[model samples]
Target: MRTPLGGNNLTAQQYESYPSADDTWTVSFNNSAGTSGTYEVYAVCLPATQAP
Candidate 1:
């Protein structure tokens, strides 16, 4: 992001994600920028198959 006077308002993004044994995901993020912005979150899932 850019400021009015040609300054950088952008900050480095830090995040982590992992799946738990219970088949759930944990998502974490840091907002170092201290600014609110629009973000879109989505996921594409597939059925789990058993190993015969």
Candidate 2:
């Protein structure tokens, strides 16, 4: 997902998912210019059998 920053109003880039045994995942976001910022990213992982 891409989201616009609150102040700069620029779209943030995001990457998600990493292989794990517990059905876990990761998320990262950066500014439009490819700079890391203070943006907050939240993600949730459900059981393998409960995922959509």
The best candidate in terms of TM-score: 1
Q: After superposition, how far is residue 20 of candidate 2 from its true place, in Å?
A: 5.0
TM-score attained by model 2: 0.39
How well does each candidate superpose onto the true structure, as a TM-score?
A: 0.46, 0.39
Runs in model 1 deviating more than 4 A are 1-26
Candidate 2 RMSD to the real structure: 4.7
lDDT of each: 0.54, 0.57
Clashes of 1: 0
Cα deviation at 33, candidate 1, in Å, is 0.8
Q: Which tens-of-lDDT digit does each residue in 1-52 have in candidate 1?
A: 2223335464435376666546676555665887665444444458899999
TM-score of 1: 0.46
Best by lDDT, which number? 2
- Candidate 1, poorest ten consecutive residues by summed lDDT: 1-10
| Worst ten in a row by lDDT for model 2 | 34-43
